[model samples]
Target: MPRAKRFYIPGCVWHITHRCHKKEFLLKFARDRNRWLDLLFRAKQKYGLEVLNYIVTSNHIHLLVSDNGNRDTIPKSMQLIAGQTAQEYNIRKKRRGAYWEDRYHATAIQVDTHLASCLIYIDMNMVRTGVVSHPSEWRWSGYNEIQNPKKRYAILNYRRLMELLGCESLDALKEVHGQWIEDSLKKGKPAREKKWSRGIAVGSREYIENIQTKLGVKAIHRKIHESKDSSELREDQSPYTAIFGTENERLRQENTYRWGLF
Candidate 1:
């Protein structure tokens, strides 16, 4: 298959996914996962990457970030993290070949309910796979970091997060976030959503169309898909964009910044 082309758009949030080479479970161990997170922290320090949410799983990684309108931030940070990770792991194991499946897949996300939904979806990943019953059970995730914030080396932009969620305080955000999780769990086993991993952009009609316009040639052939709740722009033949919904209380938060996405 041809390498997936990256579409760059400034001032947006992005959901990034990268998998281990041939799904070998390279990060199946805690130490490797921790190393990836450590490199992620350093990438934050070195590049000012505004990480919103993340999860380092056995064979893949999910990162939710608010681009700072600096085009190089995302790619550069990825290079540092992925490159160093692969190099270190290979040297440690005395192995060779690719550590990553390819490069990665990035989906632009609309802020507000869509963004919030994406956050919960990411945290629920392990739960969906039955690795754990709840997101808190998994240590390598932003959800854990948020509920139990670290005094040092913390990730996630709390203030910006609050602004995005239309909340006034961390306590409120936490309460609302937990409620969202609880509400989600009550819905039973969550199935994987393709929009986050496959779509070029996910949001409302206007938002996706706007992204498509901005993407110009790259998105020329892609099409927008509309369902009852939301709209998405996706390729002709694959998992594409999506629409979403949350009942009453979950629909409260209605909204990121000059975030560049890759």
Candidate 2:
């Protein structure tokens, strides 16, 4: 399902999930995945996107990033990466139609502990799918890049990531990252979390409410949900239904409209 109207508050971290059109295996090949990462690197160089973490799966991708106080950066970077990757793949394979599903969905995240959880959540995506036993096995993930920073062509903004995570240095961050993954695995199998993908905002009560306020009218009918450890603000009503006020907007219109009112 789609999220709440893509309302992004600057300086907030976001968990972005984008699937291939119709959930197809368009990026089933390694080269395609690598190309997608290549474009991500270009986005880093071009737009200064403060990437924190990412994972490219066969059918979709999970990208974690901070808005960095610039509203256009995230959208521009995503367009560059998604558009170029899709164009190149289509040209090479001679395919047609849409590449991605509508647009990517983003969830606002609170910094510190909540942000750490999102990072681990993105890391465990492949593991949850049974593609590999551990996130480390998935080379395309930010997991690999975090553990072993590239000498050249790096996509992540280490300084921003460190500041957001409250880490003193890269070593400290890496250690903490590894430990969190280990703890999650030991606790048992990880599952697909909807808050990261579908919710409007995921964090503490105050943080989520702040996001909702920033959204203003878009947050209408959206309510805050609390669990044992965290809180999320989500809309019970579908965005389509909220806008059109009907389960099926098409059905509400006369059949004569199929051939025009004339």
Number of the predicted model whose lDDT against the real structure is largest: 1
* Residues forming the 10-long window of minimal summed lDDT in candidate 2: 253-262
Off by over 4 Å in 1: 236-262
Clashing pairs in model 2, backbone N/Cα/C closer than 3 A: none
Q: Which window of 10 residues has the lowest lDDT sum in candidate 1?
A: 240-249
Listed in order, each prediction's TM-score against the native is 0.88, 0.88
lDDT of 1 by residue, 110-153 (tens): 99789999999999999999999999999999998778767788
lDDT of 2 by residue, 58-103 (tens): 9999999887666778888889989998999899989899999888
Predicted structure 1, TM vs. truth: 0.88
The CA lDDT at 115 in model 1 is: 96
Off by over 4 Å in 2: 1-4, 236-262
**Could you tell me the TM-score of candidate 2?**
0.88
